[model samples]
Structure formats: structure tokens, C-alpha cells
Target: MNTYSDLRLNLFCQSLLQSVGMNKENSLVVADSLIKANLEGVDSHGISRLPIYAKRFGDNRINIKPNIQMTKKSSSVLMVDGDNGLGHVVSYQAILNGIEMAKQNGVTAIAVKNSNHFGTASYFCQLACEQNLACIVLTNSPPGIAPWGGKDAFFGTNPIAFGFPTGNDQPVIIDLSTSVVARGKIILAAKQGNHIPDGWALDRDGHPTNDAEEALKGSLLPLGGAKGSALALAVEILTGLLTGAAFGPNVKNIYDNEESGKANVGHFFILMDIEKFMNLNTFFESIINLLNEMKEVPKIPGIDEIRYPGERRKRDKERRLQEGIQLPPSVEEELIKLAGQYNVEFPIPIPPLKANSIVSN
Candidate 1:
């Protein structure tokens, strides 16, 4: 394992994306999103996924130069065609369009089609929240979870994220996948040659399995069985069906190079100006008071604390910003491989570990 300051990791990600022919602005968006995931302790959506991204880029599955175009469907609705571009670039642009539209129209709904796998859904929602808006973000990916009472994979770990301001620089964020866990965690476990805990997924034969590789070949378990499946279906409908992108089994697997053209993933974003309902200050103050009330609640014995959805993430971000990110040995090796493949130097040089070092692994 190795450690790197956020700045160094950000630079490495940016340079790697640029090497794959992404424009500077697009690369920065991707880099920041990935690093933000790492900083917020969502390693499943962080730089660990970059190796696969590089592979897709090398295979020419991702458009080197995307011309993202948006069409207005109504006063408050927009549709974006990603042109097979990186999902981060496409989604960022779509959110930017939504934010601007929301500023004028109180609320905006943006649907994106023909995109690749974007990093974290919260990253986009949080972006809207940072602009003093309330946001809901949804995305669909390659099929990973099976339908209820079925063995075939049909739904991606379709995630939904919600974010809103709380009178602070950091907004309260809630992000969850319909699946028990994001598929990326399974992929990461497989890359590290580790087995997952039981009940997380079923094997190719539909039997419960702890092997990450088998889980990848099989299907992930839904978060709450049938109920989770239903939520996943809702996300699939909004992000894929409604957006006119490939849904269910029609979406190509990101790891399967033989599947054909682009991944054709889809994302849906809803941004609303906070001032639409009430004054921003009043809304934020209400949120803060509620949070405080929750924190002051009586606790069950043996529990240290009860934190909000975004509290831990905010703490993680601050600590990581000061202490840097730690990458597992397997992930570091993958990064090295990508650096060699792209003929780009790894941005951060590892330093000898010290007791008082800011970054170490």
C-alpha cells in the first residue's frame, strides 16, 4: 500500500485522463470527482476504478473528443447526448446546464444518455448543493443485480443520491445503491484477491458465495430483497428508460470488451433552487436545528455516537485533506501499470514512512 497527498493524486488522475485524450477541462472534472470520492472515504468509486477506465480508453470505447449536445425538452427539462464520452465529463456538463436552468426556472430536470460510468452520484448532487440548490441524482450502469426471485442479472447497482444545503459549506448528502453494495467494491475485492462476506451476492448458479470473482460472474444481492429490486427498477426507469439509453441487460458491461460499442450508461439529475420554497437561511437553519436535535438524542448503551448521512463523509474529507489518501498495494500496482501504459510518470513519489508523517501507508 502507498499514500499520497490529495494534490498529487489529483494531478496524477488529471494527467492520466489527459493521456487518454480527454480535454483539460474534462480531465479536471473527472480528476476532482475521483479524488473527492477518495477524500470522502468512498474508495469504491475512487481511483481504484481508474485502471478499468484506462483500459476502456485504450480500447477506444470512450470517445477521445466528445461533442456533448443538449436539447431542451421543456422550460425546466433538458436532454443531453454524451456522444460516448466519459461519464464524469458528460454528467458534469449536464449538471452545469441544469444548475443554470434551475437558477432561471426554480427547478430543472436533466437526463443524460450515451455516457460511460460516472464516479459517485453524490459528487454531482453535491455540486448542485454547493451552488445553493437541492438536488437528486440517479444513474444506471451495466447489469449487476438480479431481479427478485430470478437468477439472471438485469439491474445495475443503480444508485440514487440526494443533497441539500445545511447552512454550511458542506451540504448534507445521502447516497445509496439499491444493491447491498456498489459493484465496484466487489471489483476491488477481486483485484485484491480477497473474498467478500457472505450474503453480499450469489454465485453464477444463484447460490450464495463469498468469492469476489464468482460474485462478479454472478449477481449482487439487492439491499432489501424485493424492495431494493423495486427501487433499482425505479432508478433504471428514470436514468435509462426515461433517458432513452440502454437499460437492464441491454447496457454493456464495462469490463467486457467484447460486448461492442460504448457502455451507454445513463444519468438523471434534478436541481431546484433553494429559494423556491423559502429563504435559504431559514431552510438551512431548520436543517441545522434538526441535525442538532438528532445529535443530542439519548443513545443506546455501547454506542459512541450517531452521525448524519454526510457527517462522516465530511469528516473523512477534512482528515484526508490534511493527512492524504492511502491506496492499497494492489491499487498502487494498478496505478503503476497505467502510468507505464500511458507513458506518463506517476505524479507522487512515495516517501519513507515516519511516525509523524502527514501521509503514509
Candidate 2:
């Protein structure tokens, strides 16, 4: 395991990305998104993905310099073409436009196409939250989950996220995948030579398996059986069909070297200005009252406290910032190789603490 401060890690990532033909501004945005995911304990979407991204860039699967364009469909609707750019760069630009339109027209809907994988959806939501706006984010990915009662993979492990500003500095953010677990978790396990728990996925022959590699060749189970499959369908339509991007199994998988083409991932974002409906303070007070009531009523055995959505993430970010972000040996080794390949300086790891040095006084 290796630990690193966020600033040093960000610089290392930026250097590596720039070496791969990405511009400085876009590299900074991508690195910030990856590091923030690690800080919030979502390691699946963190810097562990750098190797795959670099490979795609080298293969010409993702454009190094994309021409992102936006069109105004109406007073509250906008369309974006990423021109095969990184999802982080495309989505960040789209959300900024959406927020501005919402401030003028109460709400805005933005559809993005021809993009690659974006990090966690909550990151974009946090941007809207900073402006006291409510937002819903949806995105389609490469196929990983299967439809209800099906043996083959069909729908992507599409995710949906919602964000709302509150009286406190922390906003209410809910982000989740329609699958029983995120497919990235299985990919990370496979990379680390670890076994996954049962019920997360099935083998290629439709049998349950704990092996991460086999699970990758198979289909992931839905979050709640048929219900989750249904939600995934809705996201597929909104992000893929409605946005004119690839749908269902047609979305190209980023990890498959044999699949030669763009990912064509799609995203949908809706931003709503709170002041349009009512006073922002009144809405904050109502949300606070509701949260307090819920906390006052919750206590099960072995439970310490009741935390609202995004609260634990906020706490994790705080602790990680104070200490440091730890990376697994597998991820660190891959990063080191990339550093050498790109002729970039790698960040020095924080030394592990010695047990004998601890003195309890």
C-alpha cells in the first residue's frame, strides 16, 4: 500500500495526462475528479482508471483535443456534442451552461453525447449545489448488467444522482447504481487478484461465481431484481436513446481492446433553481426540520448514529484530507509504470508508521 497527499497526487496525474496529448486545462479537470473520488472513498472511480484511459488515448479511441459544441434547443433545453472527448471535460462544461440557464428560466435540461466515462455523478451535482441549485444527473455506460431473468448482459450499470442544497454547508446528495454493485468494484477486485462476494455477479454459464474475472465475463445482478432493471431501462432511454448515443449493448466497452470504436456514452442533467419555486431560506428550514426529525427517531442495535445521504462522504473526505489517501499496491505499481513511461516524477509515498514508536502516555 502507498499513501499520498492529494496535491502531489493531482500533480502527478496531470503530468501523466499531459504526456498523453491532453491539454493542461482538461487534464486538471480530469485529475481533480479522480482525486475527489478517492477522497470520498469511491476508489473504483478514482486514479486506478488512469492506465485504461491512457491506453484508450494511445489507441486513438478517445480524441486528445475534442471540439465540444452546444446548441440551445429552447429556453430550458440544450444539446451538447462532446466530439469524443473525455466525459469529465464534456460534462463539466455542460453543467456550467445548465446552471446558468436554470438561473434565468427556473430549470434547464441538458443532454450530452459522444463522451467517455465520467467519474462519480455526485461531483457534477456538487457543482450545482454550490450555486444553491437542485440537480439530477444520469449517465449510460458500457453493458455490464443483464435484463430481468436474462443470462446475457444487456443494460449498462446506469447510475442516477440527485443533489439539493441545504442550510448547512454540506448538501444532500444521493448517488447510486442500478446494479447490485458497481461493475467497477468487480474490475478493481480482478486487478487486485481478489475474490468478490457471491450474489454480486454470475458466471458466463449463468451460475453464481465469486471469481472477479469470471464475473467480468458474465452479467451483474440488478439492485432489487426487476425494479432495478426497470430503472436501468429508464436511464438508457434518457441518456442513450434521447441523446442519440449508443444504447444497451451497443455502447463500446472501454476495457475491451478488440472493440475498436468510440465509447459514445451519453449523459443527462437537469438543474433547478430553488428561488424560482419559493424562498431559499424556507426550503432550507424545511429540509433541516425533516432531517432532524428523522435523526431523532432512528436507533437500532449496534448502530451509533443516523447519517443522511452524502454525510458519510463528507466525513470521509475530511478524514482523508487530514491523514492521506492510500492506494493499493496493485494500483500504485501501475501508476509507477505509467510515470516511467511518460518521464514524469512520481510522488513519494508516505512511510508506514512503526508500531514500536507509538508511546501511550
Candidate 2 residue-wise lDDT, 1-361, digit = tens: 7678877888889999999999999999999999999989999999999999998999899887999999999999999999999899999999989999999999999999999999899999999999999999999999988899998899999999999999677899999999999999999999999999989998888889999999999999999999999999999999999999999999999899799889999999999999999999999999999888988886999998888999999998877776678899999999999899889999986556721232211
Give the poorly placed runs of model 1, Cα more than 4 Å off. Answer: 349-356, 359-361
- Stretches of candidate 2 off by over 4 Å are 354-361
Q: Give the TM-score of candidate 2.
A: 0.97
What TM value does model 1 have?
0.96
lDDT digits (tens) for residues 128-201 of candidate 1: 88889999999999999999998878999999999988877768899999999999999989989999998899
- Report residue 237 deviation for candidate 1 (angstroms): 1.0
Candidate No. with top lDDT: 2
Query: Candidate 1: minimum summed lDDT over ten consecutive residues — where?
Result: 352-361
Error of 2 at 356 (Å): 15
